[model samples]
Target: MRRPAAFLNLIFSRRSIRRFRPGKIDAEVLKIILEAAQSAPYYYQAFCFILLEKPEIKREINESCGGDFIEKAGASIVVCLDLNRISGLLDRLGIVHVLKADTYPVESVLGVFESGLAVMNLIMAAEVMGYGTLILDCALYECERISEILKLPHGVIPLVIVCIGEKDENPPPRPRWPLESLFHVDGYRMLSDEESERFLENMDKAYSVEGYLKKYAGWAGSYREYLANRALLTREVRRAYESISAFLRRSGFRP
Candidate 1:
């Protein structure tokens, strides 16, 4: 058994590595990591992991996602929610032609959540195996194209691509909001004006404290401005949403 302290150490030490050394992970180790990921809790195991190892596939994914990091990683796993699997199970149970238009969205949400848990488990497993990991939703921008390239089936919708490789950089942890500001006892309570002001002040202090913000100089910006600019809420993001909606319709998962 791992020492309690060591387990906690591993959790705290893991980071999202953007760069990686050119090396391949052993097949056995990769298998173990995947096994750990599959161990994640789920409602109905309605998800699948697509392991991408081919250089040509990785290159195409990188090109489509507008990044080289995915290609550089030793391996990438695309987490997909298998709506078809769920429907197949329903069919096997003799629930023929049940119109689940309203409930399908909830099922999709639960499937995505379960998939997220599995991906996180895999990330931790990779880190424990002494490999760096990075998760990206950039692939969602070209989800339809990537799915076609990967030859994904009708009901499997790709959520995120996780890259695994040897670490090439060490970086400090990003700032997080204080627990007091975020958590409320028993039932949730909205913060008052004064409390909100204090929270913001604490957040700024945390950002500048230990020179963390300085390390990310020019990379930092105001969230207010970011929201105002609506830069990330691009047509591509909207189209991606529309594509997913269409996929659901095509998969017969809609009302």
Candidate 2:
């Protein structure tokens, strides 16, 4: 078990810092943070992170993402995978090929999950090093235009972006589901209809305090809404996934 006090402190203390002080992060510090990201587990995939510091490139990216604030940070880190290498290995193993849209759907989801975990490591390390981080997936992957801006090869796609700098303010921790409702002694336990209703009702009430409309049912309603907000993205991501998968097959990675 972790020390609750220490863990709680970390949980409450960390916030997504958007405004960065104008200065360069020490080269050694950047190296350590990148190393922390590389330590994350990856399944049959290689991860590469790109650091963006050039003003011109940052400006172009900011324009592509439709958010000029992306250029404000000291630097932006983007995570990508070499899909061409992944596909070739899958071909040899006679496993599912990532080129097919059906086979690549779940694979893309898993790949994104891995990239997210890696970025999280960098964020945590930044906090410990007395820096702040705001991870935004859009800055690196707003649309197909971003790929052109990054000059990403057919098989390489930007998965996520993390902005690092010093925090200017403290952010309060939001409420979470109760611990009892969160854990089960053993096996899997799905939420009962009764519990589901109460769960969402309580959540709606909770967010009401913050002057938000509704929390929706459980978490899916809110998630679905968020997904819909970027509904047009489904096509771009699918195309990018196939592009990388084809590249991976050409490389050496298996399905």
Candidate 3:
């Protein structure tokens, strides 16, 4: 096999950066990044990128979503699933019968999926240009507040906030499920009990080496325990779920 290209190496080296050095992204560079995002494949092109450089707006987003790192970044882009734009275009073209209520659910899913692909392109372009990126889903926890802050119209939902800036931290790459556990050839494979235990053991070892449990959840003895106690469906998580669900329905993304 041919050696992996530099772009593949860049993808492998990319990390979710939270701490960023103070600096402003040049307008031309940001334009290039956004153009790369627009090149992503799409089903309906139902997405919009709202670039936020104002400190006050970033601070408001931080307050709403509890992502203080957002204010510290050079800039943030809110990737919105904007079905409203598609609907407007359809109306302008007199395509009245296209977007019915039954199609809303499929369109919503496609919009979100396309938004993710565009976001990946944006992130990779930034990374290749020597900027760190952080994808924050915390916006989902306060979707209504984010909508208000961004002045989004109905059918426009903030799907993610991407923070871009120079890096200030160099944390180790986080662990993931083993390839055998995640990948399957031709069909899905159910993990055996022993395989599950091995995966957990590997994760525990990696997290232990990184002192992740000690720093984040001192009470938890292992990665498994930490996930169960702190990362699973806790009260705060349930509240976030409710908030996102309600906002999706109100924004016309759900039936």
Candidate 4:
């Protein structure tokens, strides 16, 4: 695949940024970036973007989700799925019962897909325009509280929060699995023990524990501890999953 040099550079140089300088993005630039996000391909689902530039709200979100970088960054954009809009349209068409009858695989799954597509578009656009962005999954853990904070409606579920601003730090790209490991020929193929071990060794060398700590020093914990901490990974993550599921059901997305 022969990609243009500009597109390849954008893809290759993009990185998840945590630290940011104190400066607001230009209004015109922000508008164009949001327009890029809106241009993403969605499968008939309406999405909403909430821009948060207020210092107090950013502080509240930082306290709630424990991602301090959010407050330090320039702004946060909350990407939400507008189920109410879809439901309203369906109701007007007199076919809202179709969703009520078969909701398992549609409402819950497709909304996420649409939001992810738009977010990626926004991220790439910001990166190309000399800005940094971070996708904050912590918002989902405190979904209800965040909903209240953002003043979101009952059917508008916050899918992901994106932090965008001027970059304060330049970091190297994170290590990824080798092409052979990620790209299986035609179908899925599980890696053997040796292959898996080799991959782990390569990653360990590419990104040592010291490197991880230095990069995310604000987290204030070892990488191993971060991974082993059940409070954040298991408990909070499970709660986030349940919250989204319950939100969908309560919003009449159940069969």
Query: Which candidate's lDDT is highest?
Result: 3
**Model 1 agreement with the true structure over 38-146: per-residue lDDT tens digits:** 9999887878888888888888888887667787888888888887777777877766544345444667677878998999899999988899999888655567878
Q: Go through the candidates in order and give each one's C-alpha lDDT.
A: 0.77, 0.66, 0.85, 0.77
Q: Model 4: C-alpha RMSD to truth?
A: 3.1
Worst 10 residues of 1 by lDDT: 217-226
Name the best candidate (by TM-score): 3
* Candidate 3 Cα RMSD (Å): 2.2
Clashing pairs in 3: none
After superposing all C-alphas onto the true structure, candidate 1 shows an RMSD in angstroms of: 3.7
Q: Report the lDDT tens digits of candidate 4 across residue range 1-255.
A: 776999888899898888899877788998989999989998765678888878899888889878577777777888887777776778788664545554465775677788889999999989888999999876665677888888877677776789899998888878787888878777999888888777767655656643864566444544445445634657767876787667656655442
Per-residue lDDT of 1-57 in model 3, one digit per residue for the tens? 996789888988898887899988889999999999999998999999998877888
Error of 4 at 32 (Å): 0.5
Tell me the RMSD of model 2 versus the true structure.
6.4
TM-score of 1: 0.82
Local accuracy of candidate 2 as per-residue lDDT tens digits, 1-255: 767796567757787775677777788999999888877787655456878877888888777655444677766877775564565667788876554443345565566677777887888888888898887766334534566777766555666677887666555444566666778887767777777667666665555564333322133344335435546567877887686556444433335
Judged by whole-model lDDT over C-alpha atoms, candidate 2 comes out at 0.66
TM value for model 2 = 0.68
Model 2, residue 174: C-alpha shift (Å) = 2.5
Query: What's the CA error at residue 89 for candidate 2, in Å?
Result: 7.8
lDDT of 4 at 156: 78
